[model samples]
Target chain A: MGEAIVITSGKGGVGKTTTTANLGTALALAGKRVCLVDTDIGLRNLDVVMGLENRIIYDLVDVVQGRCTVQKALVKDKRFDDKLYLLPAAQTSDKTAVTPEQMKKLIHELKQDYDYILIDCPAGIEQGYRNAVAGADGAIVVTTPEVSAVRDADRIIGLLEKEENVRSPRLIINRIRGHMVKNGDMLDIDEIVMHLSIDLLGIIADDENVIKASNNGEPIVLDPNSKASIAYRNIARRILGESVPLQSLEEEQKGVFAKIKKFFGMR
Target chain B: MNRQKQQYVTIKGTKDGLTLHLDDTCSYHDLVMELEEKLSVNQTNEPDGPLVAVHLKVGNRYLTPEQEEEIRTLIRTKKNLVVESIDSNVITKEEALGWKRKTEIVSVSKIVRSGQILHVKGDLLLIGDVNPGGTVIAGGNIFILGALRGIAHAGYYGNKEAVIAASVMKPMQLRISDIMSRSPDYKSEERNEMECAYIDDNNQIVVDRLQLLTHLRPHLTRLERRL
Candidate 1:
């Protein structure tokens, strides 16, 4: 059976959804039959990010409540063809509408057909979080280098460690800026790993292309030239148990002039 | 008269004193009337008895000053009766004795998360880290095998000699009896040595290495004897 992994971060706006979209696409590019399930319920956005929002006639709630079959609710990504699928969350229903048992049953059904099931969990440690993690075999905790995000990530890691099925949830340090870390203005990957005490899965640098790709309803992993795309591919490889060395973020500096511009609050 | 109404005001004689148990659900008017009737019956039964102090036990109810005064006046009306003191019947004298005799240590092996409060009647021993925003309160001593990062209050019921011992003593607040000490801001270090905190001779909370705590062991032993 395929593994179900939950992508969660306890705090909001810390790149959980973005990480889910990119990682799902990266795994699909690697020729794995992947299913991206959005467990955010009322705040669903995964379908929009995958450019499958318009094609969604049935959703996760419809499948769970038996209004539609799991196969009917699964929306195949146009770009990935049949390789990647999106099970969009119900935008009108809240998290309470779905129970953890229902999510477990849904994930069990998806696991039979897909090689990888990635659950995009909603922010916060409530019912939505429980539903997302109910059937996952592993968890990927995403966090920014900021103190608040790291603190919440620590709590999430602590929770995942306590789960019966989750075995040592991996950490993803997102939104890293090499110049900020070099200037001692932001926490580096090493410092964050030391504080959180979790194995580092991968690090994605702060790239404007990520935002542009999201706005265009395209995952950055599809754009092979983007820095985030390469980083996401490395993460997917690492997840598949490949020993890939980390990319050197320090080597791609923006020069002294750029630093001076950044210092003066200019983009 | 209802048997339940009659049982509302129970009069019992003990070796130390006489106890008057007032029912928790009885109205104030009914309590006063029942108490007066009981006292009059006792007075007529023993006409030439000496004055006896009566302890009023109101079960889990706070008595107003006016109600207390009314009860005291009713007791004084009987020439051979006097108001000793007002106490709650929620916990009986035997129950208090049982608590004092309790030397059991409660042990917990899970991480105490935020917004969780663990209160133990006797000594408490925890085998996991107490996270921030959590609280650990004990009537006796507290011993943490892991990091004590949360608030720990030992000797919450006023046992001045109770101590708090932890492997890593970086708690937000350490309290012993009435004295409380906030943890000082310090750099994180591998604290291989355990520490013990207790109220010193100067009436201030002081933390010392576990090895040095032997000097205070005799005092703690004496306090246990008193208990």
Candidate 2:
């Protein structure tokens, strides 16, 4: 059976959904069959980010509640050509609609068919979070390079470590402003990793295009050249047992020569 | 002199109070008989005189609560004789075990993460870091061999004399018994060296170098020795 991994963060607005979408897309791009399960029942956004919102018919609640079969609830993403599927959460129901035991059984059923199952956990340590972590073989904790995000990540790691089923969670420091980190204005990836004291999978830089892609209903990993997209791909490769060195996060200021070079290439 | 030594009961009046001595080696039956007879002789000259307090000393003998109460009832018959205290040289096995637990040191090696609490009945020796929002409480003392970035309440069971020592002492809050010292009030020392906290003579928890623990509570290291 394939392994299931849960992506979780204790606090809200820390790029958990974004990380989940990008990692799911990246893993699928590597020719591995991947199923992305969204456990954020009421606050469902994974389908929209994956651009599969319109195709969702039977959701996670319907499958868990035995209203529909697991196959009927899965939404195929034509972009990956049968490699990627999105099991969207129900937008009408809350987290209590599903329990951890039911989720564990459902995930176990899905694990038989997929190469990798990535469960997108909710923002808090509530029923949704527990349900997402119930059957996972591993966990990934996402956070930004800020005090609040790091503190919340610490709390989530504390909870995840207590789980007997889930493996030790790794760290992903997202939204790293290169210039800000260079100027000591923000917490660096090293500082965040050292503070959290977990293995660093990869670090995603603060790219505004990440927001643009999410708003446009596209996973950032589709754009392979972008900083955040490449970071996601690296983390995905690391998860697949490949050792990839971290990309440098210090984007320096444009010097006068670069400005003159840009003048020469006038549009 | 030999017959006096053989007697199971002895009563005397010192300069202050009357002392009642019970022979421990004699049979329980004989001891009770001699005690009753000795006090019965004094019951005749009783109520007319003033109340005289007596101290009962039972050497190397364990007395059950019921047997002690029986002795107290027998003393009550002598209206003039009042029992002040009962002293024994031996304690129950349960009490001895409790004393052992109170002095035992528990060694733990794990990251005390946020919102997690590690508490023990006796002294705690943690070999891992305590992240912020975590707590470690001990009935005796807390000794952390790693960083302490959280709250530590030593002497949780009202042991005001308990102490907290850490390799990296940056605790957000420190409590020794009822007294507490929070950040800003406590010098937020990010010092790398080891530091220990204890209630000083001023009744305030003070953080100082770890070596001072030997001077502050010299008896802390006196009970057990390691080669």
Candidate 3:
């Protein structure tokens, strides 16, 4: 059976949906059959992130509530050539429309076909969180370096640890600004990991291109030269048990002298 | 002593001290006479014994100041006797209830998450961090062994004497009784030391280092001794 991973963070706007989209696309590009499941229900955004919003005729709630079959609800990504699919969440219905048992049953069926099923969990440790984590075998908790975000991430990690199926959730430090870290204004990765005490899966630095890619309905992982895309591809490899060295975020912006030298072709 | 005089006054020994039960139905003269007789006999029997503090219980009756003074004078006549307290039936009942409330303590060892609230009916002893957006309300004092970045309302039930102590006390808002104080916007680098919050003489919430808490309430050391 394929591994079902839940992407969750207790606080909102910390890039849980973005991570799910990029990681799912990257995994598919690595020759894996990936199905991205959006479990946010009323606050669905994964469909828009994947550029599959128009193709979602039947959603997760419809499949769970017996309104449609899983195959009918699954939307194939045209860019991936049948390797990537998305099961979108219902825009009208809330999280309570589907129970944990129904989610577990749906995931069980999907596991028979897909290589990886990534659930985009909603924020907060409430009913939505329970439903998203109910069927997952592993979890990825994303968080920013801010104190509020780290505090909520700690709570999400605590909850994930208590689940029988979720094997020790990994941490993804998102939106890290190296300049701020160097200036002692922002928390470092070591400090966050020390506070949370979870395994580090990947770190995606703050990149303006990520926002542009999201606005254009494309994950950064689709672009080879984007720094954030490179980070997401590395994260996908790390998830597949590859020993990939972390990319240094500090060197992305070249100094003015180096830019001038390159412009003048000085050798 | 006559059977009626014996019924008017009764003396009992306890672990902490002695208890004197005075009946309101009897005449004041008889009550004083019987109490003096018991004290004289008790002093003669144990002349060199350790001093035993006496607590008087006047059932369903209010004693005039003169009558109360007479009882105190009679008990003090003996060298081995000392009056600890004078209580009426109403005060004794209230004290029993107060003791029951004071003995209750809620101990939680889990980290209080965001959007989670914990309300304790008595003193609270927490061994985990209270994250931002979390709230802890205690009727009495609150003791936290970890960082307190959330709202902690000690003395929730209007107990101004209650205190809140934490190892790393950078709370979003600290409330003692009805007074509330929010932490400054800038973070302090010296959070390694423990800090305590309590009501000051002006009835405002004041936070100081844990060691200096004794200066605010001198009886805190005595209470810690009992613990």
Candidate 4:
């Protein structure tokens, strides 16, 4: 049976959808049968990020409500060649449209066929988050280096640890600006992990291409040389029980003249 | 006369009023019957003078508040008698348990994460970090062996004498009883020593070094060594 892992951040605009899309694609790239379940309901965006917006006919609400078969609701990702599929969330319906019990049943049915089911959770810890976490065997708490995001992640982790089905949740620090961390401006990886006291799954550096690729309906993991893509692949390998070393981030420093200019307070 | 010699209810005169000693070995019904008979016999001596104050003493017998009230009502039924006090040598087991719960220290070893609150009846000895947005409340004192970056409310149940001590004493807010004091806004004070917060004589929450607790609350130490 497949394992269902929910990707959630208690605060909004923290790259939960991006992580879900890239991780699912990375797992698919590793030849694992991956199913991405979007549980955001009214504010679904996983389909758009995966470039499968036009393909979604029957959504998560339809499958759980018995309006359509699970096979009928699944949108296949042609890029992965039968390796990846997405169960989109219904844009018209709210979080109350689906119940946690129905979500659990639906995920249990999907687990029989897929190797991994990544549930893309909504922002708040309400019904949508509950439905996303209901069937999750494990969880991935995504957060940025910002204090607000970290605080919300801590709250979510506390909630996740109380779940009977979900195991110890792991952390993924996303959108880290390497230079700001080097300059001791932003919260670094070690500080956040120490504060949250959870096992660090992986960290993704902030790259311009991530936003650009998402804007074009393609996840960053499609580009092999993309830094964010490489990080996602490493995270996927770690999820597959591979001990790949975490990629250390080092910002591109300028020449001696730039350092002199920086000393003189030049931009 | 033999029954009078083995009386279960004894009354004695004092300068202020009279003291009624109820027999600890007798049943509740027998004690009530004898007391009623004795009071009725003395009814002729009453009503001519002012009300006689009566103090009921139950030796080695624990009486519930309701039972004590019943005895008071029995005495008050007479127009010349008024109950001044009800004294007992023993207490109910529930009261003993409640006292023990209020005085004993509860030890916990877990992270009090954000949005979570740990509450203990008496003193708390927490061995984990209180993350930001988390809270730890205790009826007695609070002693944290780890970082306290969140809120700590010692004496939450209105125990004005309670204190909160932490190893890394950097909390967003500290409350002792009704008084609250927020940590200084500056984050540059990085030298985190063992610190404690307690209510001062001026009715304010004061955060100071943990060492001050030795002089401030010397009675907190309950350890007695004979060896």
- The candidate scoring highest on TM-score is 4
Per-residue alpha-carbon lDDT of candidate 1 for residues A179-221, written as tens digits (9 for 90 to 100): 8998999988897876566689999999999999998899999
Q: lDDT (CA) for every model shown? A: 0.86, 0.89, 0.88, 0.92
* DockQ result, candidate 2: 0.63
Candidate 1, residue B154: Cα displacement in angstroms equals 3.0
**Arranged by DockQ, best first:** 4, 2, 3, 1
RMSD of 1: 9.8
Is candidate 1 or 2 superior in lDDT? 2
Candidate 3 regions exceeding 4 Å error are A10-13, A30-32, A53-57, A77-83, A91-97, A123-130, A145-169, A183-200, A215-218, A241-246, A253-267, B1-107, B120-123, B185-191, B214-227
**What pairs collide in candidate 1?**
none
Candidate 4 or 1, higher DockQ: 4
Better of 1 and 2 by DockQ: 2
Best by lDDT: 4
True contacts kept of 3: 0.24
Question: How do all models score by TM-score?
Answer: 0.69, 0.88, 0.69, 0.90
Instruction: Flag regions of model 1 displaced more than 4 Å.
Output: A182-184, A188-191, A247-251, A254-267, B1-128, B134-140, B143-146, B156-158, B184-195, B208-211, B218-227
Worst 10 residues of 4 chain A by lDDT: A245-254
Q: Lowest summed lDDT over 10 consecutive residues: which window, candidate 2 chain A?
A: A258-267
For residues B80-132, what per-residue lDDT tens digits would candidate 4 score against the true structure?
78999888888777877787777778999989999999998888999999999
